[model samples]
Target: MKNTLSRLKYLYRKASRAGADYYNAPYRAAIARARREEDDLFMLLVFSEMMGIPNPAGWYCMELQPLMLERFHDWHTRMGMERSPLDNFRCC
Candidate 1:
């Protein structure tokens, strides 16, 4: 009887996890997409000057470049670009 109860508890835990995952899948996906969009916007703000668009806050945004350096490569790749147009900070 003890063995049967333990097995039932294990099965219940497994089912609970599966149900939670199913319910949270859409929220997880939406969060991921929102993060991606936010990242893209941040990159644009930081590199607008390179793209020939004069950003009023370009000077201020420059300070964030170093912090965002690690994501530069992934950002460009996600944009489906072969290379970053900014020559000074190549992420390819």
Candidate 2:
């Protein structure tokens, strides 16, 4: 796992363009892992990437980021989590 993340970091640094090489492959895995850990960071990365938002980490950055994020949120809500952050962070 450490090597995987290290490889990702190396690739990220070696990458030329920003949005062009958003995610390779392991980065996607890292994002999925990250999602299981936290909702805010995961959603933020997914939403930002799907909307073409620039992210240096390139972690939650894939063409299907939007769909995955939606599914993740749905699953989370179904599991009894709140979704009030969409309207206002303060509300949650």
TM-score winner:
1
- Rate residue 24 of model 1 by lDDT: 88
TM-score against native, each model = 0.68, 0.25
As for candidate 1, its clashing pairs are none
Indicate the TM-score of model 2.
0.25
> Could you tell me which 10 consecutive residues in candidate 1 have the lowest summed lDDT?
83-92
The CA lDDT at 22 in model 1 is: 96
Model 1 CA deviation exceeding 4 Å by range: 1-25
In candidate 2, which residue pairs get closer than 3 Å at backbone N, Cα or C atoms, i.e. clash?
none
Summarize candidate 2's per-residue lDDT along 49-89 as a digit string, tens digits: 43467877666365545556546656446556675334322
